[model samples]
Structure formats: C-alpha cells, structure tokens
Target: MPSTTRRTAVAALALAASSVPMLAGTASASSHPSTVVSAPLAKGLYQSAYSERHHVLWATTAVGRPPVTSSALLKVDPKTLKVQATSTPPVTDAATGAVEAVYGVAVDDEHDTVWTTNTRNNSVAVYSQRTGKHLATLPNVAHAREVVVDERHDLAWASGFGDGTVVAFDTRTFKEKKRVTVPGAAPAGLAVNERTGTAYATDLKGNRLIAVSPYAKDPSFIPAGNGPISVALSPDGRTAYTADQAAGGISVVDLRKKSVTRTIPTGAGTLSVATDRRTGRVLVANRTAANVTIVDPAKATVTETLPTGPNPNHVTVAGTTAYVVDKSGAGPEGRDQVHRIRLGR
Candidate 1:
C-alpha cells in the first residue's frame, strides 16, 4: 500500500453528507439470498480486478515504504480468479512507487484489450489480453483513480484525483481524445450508461457526483452525500449508487433527477458499490466490517448483510457471481485478498 495519510473520520462524515446523488426508489419488493466464497490473496493488494469479457484479472503488487518501487501487473484467469501471467512494464521513476497502484480495471471486449489506472503513478497501462503483452503507457494522469471502457462509444475514460478531470482515450490507439473537468477533486470511481453516453464520476474530496455529458460542456453536478468513493449504475441506467467510505452507507442517485434521493446505511467504510441488474439489488462492500450489505433501492432499505473477505474494496458481478477484492490492511503496507458471493441464491 502507498504511504499517504488516511482519510480522517470527519472527512469521512463529510463524504457521507455530500456524496449521495439524487437516487430514485425503484427497487421492487424482491428478496434474494447471498452465497459467499472466501479466498486468500497476495500481499500489497490495492484494488485491481478481473475483466470477465477479456478473460483476465489485472492486479497490482506494491513494494517498499512510501511505495517507491514500481507496481507489478499480474494477469489472472477470469473464470478461475487466479494469476494467468505477469509483467512489470517500465514506469516513470517519479511514479515508480505509485505506478501500477492499479485501482481500476476495464476491458474492451470487442477489441480484446484491458486498461488499468495507477493511482500513485499518475499513468494508465494498456495491455493486450490475447497476447499477454503491454501495449502502451499513457503518462501524466493526475490522480488517475479509476478507468471504465465504453465499448459502444469505443472510448476509455479515467477519473483524475489531482486535477478533478475525467480523461478519455481511444481504446485501440491509446490516444487522448477528450478531457472533461468536474466540480471537485479526487475522482475515485466511475460508471457509464452506454445507452445514454452519460459518464458518472464520484468525487472523493467534494462529496458530490458529477454527471459528464461525454458530448456536452460543463457536465451537470449531483450531490452524492459524504465520502462518495465508488459508483455503479443500475442495469436499466435509470439509477446510480455511490459507496460513501467515510459515511458508512451508499448514496442513491437518480439519473433522471440528477439528485441524491437518499443515503442508505450499509456498514463502516463502504468501500465499493455494485448493482445486480438482474436482481435489482445494490451490493455494498463494507471494508471495515468485512461484509457486504444488500440494498433494496425500491424500498430505500438494506435488505440483507453478509460476511465477506477482510477489507473488501471492490465489488464486481459476473453472470450470477459477485467478486469482492479485500485489502486486509487499510494503509500502504497492507496485504490483499479476494472473495466471492453468488447473488439471487
């Protein structure tokens, strides 16, 4: 883990307050059981995840204090969730410690390419899944926290932590296309509604969610409550949910209203949020609690909470299985793990 100061309790509270985007209560009266699978992972696990469409998982292994060493990109089987291959691409010396602080992973299923953002390195790594090779390195991404590939538009966008800018790229050529600025800083997580070409970004510092037009200037801003860190859109694109790290809950945002409808409490350090479009239930990884809370958006209620890996950071859905990445240590020197749960069981 990188050796930066942890977000304060007060800051977390503020994040809870400002990070909740206006969300609509659209969850139907449906209940589902959760099936959990616990697994151990390597050390220094930050937040990279597997790309099912590309059949590989992108993971970062950090080393050294202040994390001066360059990050390692390890490839894994999407189906098995184990390492398939590995590579250590050349990174900037200034960013060596942070390069590959791989927080986000996205796959261009159509192009057979994978993309990841190095939070500490301030760069993006483009790799080929079929060939198991590093394709290109795009540098100078200020606080590049998360990346999402919009296959419909053939573009990859990253959330910038330092400049509060949303960076977009051509998935094929790794060329810069557009940079959209938001109203806040520390853009941590992202989600896109391809049907609408609307990209939603969660601002870690501003406690707000900014909806970028991806086609217009000055994307609209929506309140997300406090500590808005990660975001996920509903399968239908009508609603978006943000995990409030400091606030201990998930902020529900209604895309149609562009406002936060409510903050649904989950657990301590709501690290990540993912919605099961098939089941219409929102899952939140409570990092501090080592469990996940299932939220019913229709009733604005937390229907069920289930235990998971230690310090679960990101929640991903594949077919019917939900995978959660857990970095046991909260700070820069921590180890990592991954867990799985079957939804609608």
Candidate 2:
C-alpha cells in the first residue's frame, strides 16, 4: 500500500464520502440470487478487477476530460466495500505537466503488479501491487481503453481504441513485444487466455471480435453484434462472450467455429461482461439501464437483473462475488461508486 505521506498527498483526488447506504442487500425476484452493497469511491469510475491472490479489488477513475488532472488507482476490500489504498499517476505530460489519468485496470497477480490504461493520455502504466508505486508508463498507445495480463506468458495486452490496434508488452521487461492492427476497427475491451497466450479484443466500430494469437501470422476476426465494447472468455477458452453496447445484448462466439452462435439480449447499453469460473455464469453491466444482468450461458438466457446505481460501467468477478463500478451517485454532483455483489455459491 502507499505510504501515509503519499496517501495524504493524493487524498484530495478521492471522494470524501465513504460507503453509500446499502443499495440492495436482499436478493431480487429472479432465478439467480445475489445481494448488492455500494460505496462512493471517486469521480469517473470506469473499470475494476479483483485480485484473487491479494483478496482485494482494483479500480480506475479519471476525473473530467482533456488534460485530466485528477485520476486514481484504488485498492479496495471486497468484503467491506471500503477503499484500502489510493495511488495517483505521476505527471507524464512534460509539455502540459498533466498526470496520466487511469481508466482501465487489470491485476497481474503472477507478478504482484497492476496494469492500468491511461486512456486520455494514450498510454498504459504499471504499478506495484504491494507498495502502490508507479513502476513504468508505456506511452504512444493510441487511446488505450483496456488492458489484460497473460501472466502465464508474462505479457500485458492493451487495446488501442483509437488506432484499431492491440499491443502486447513484456510484463517482466516493460517493453513492447508485439503489435497487431486491424484497419478501420476501434478496439475497446480486451481479454487474454493465459493458457494459450491468445488475446481477444472487441471491435466497437466494426462489430467484430479480433483474435490475436501468439504464433499466428495474421489475426482472425469473428463476427459479433453491433458495437462490442467489452469481452470475456469461458474457463475452457472455447467460448468468447462480448458485451455489445450499441445492440444492447451479449454476443456468444464459438471460438472453434469463429462465429457468434447466439446474441442474447441482456439490457440497454450492455457495456461490460465477466464470467464466473465457479458457476460459469456470465455477468453483464448495463450502463444505460443501470443494472447488472446475470446470464446463464448454458441455457442462453438471462437469469436475473440486479439493479445497481446509475450508469453501471464495469463488473468483475472475484470468486462467487461480483464488483460493479458505476459513474453516477444519489447526490447532485454524481460521484462514482463501487458495488460489491455477493453471489452466493
């Protein structure tokens, strides 16, 4: 965690409010049962990842647009829904002296580090998981939107949302290892299969899923629904699920056949998706609907609709629990919040 001095210096960047009133403690009237607890974290909460090894949740937030001055990487206790530590990015823009605001986050448990996408600055940064120290910043990544680490291969993959590209960096060396481009495609969310060293990215503009294999000469593309912004893979890595934002549905792709087998309507503006390894259930965050939809992939049907706060941006599973980060609040300023959804086993 960050030192007392460092935390105090960045305290102004975090929202002073603590946990919000419990939003949903009882299970909804649905097939899938779960409880929701939310806490106001900061402004502009975008994404979150749960670190199984550390038993903590990692989230990213960037305040305001252009020349974003306030942004932070938060470490929170999943059980209590309380922030444990906060670290701000170091100023990397020498010309403007503005800090790189973090938006997307992924935990590299194998290396005990966290990778964050500095979306506004077109770069990605590495931070120490234990000490909350800024380790490295790889710049020139065009509009980096999401990052996922392939710990088995020691690589960190980032989606270049603006450039239609995906770049992989050696986690150990912090150097660019490979770059793959799909012209005219705007790649958004990214997911890597650590077992195979293969990465899948959502093409928001092209309505496709771009597959980047480590040994393949050319990347492959699988047709998806409209504006697939975020993606997740099954435990076996044979199925790829995409959250289609524009279509307001979930695209289930058969990796072996390289085709979308089904498009299940989840909710309005399905922005993010994550699979629970324990139950094989898929959770989708619907931003516009302000709820989290739980889909049973086996039956290809939505089992439950968990109403979160407004603008649910992202959801990540830790064990049977799911953490949802939203961009709206009950108050006037609309501070962002992080929700802990207990999905009982």
Off by over 4 Å in 2: 1-32, 93-97, 331-333
Candidate number of the best TM-score: 2
TM-score of each: 0.83, 0.91
Give Cα distance to truth, residue 310, candidate 2, Å.
0.6
The residue-by-residue lDDT of candidate 2 on 73-99, one tens digit each, is 999887666679999899867787578
Q: In candidate 1, which residue ranges exceed 4 Å CA deviation?
A: 1-32, 64-67, 78-80, 94-101, 329-335
Each prediction's RMSD to truth: 9.4, 6.4
The prediction achieving the highest lDDT against the true structure is 2
Cα lDDT, model 2, residue 332: 31
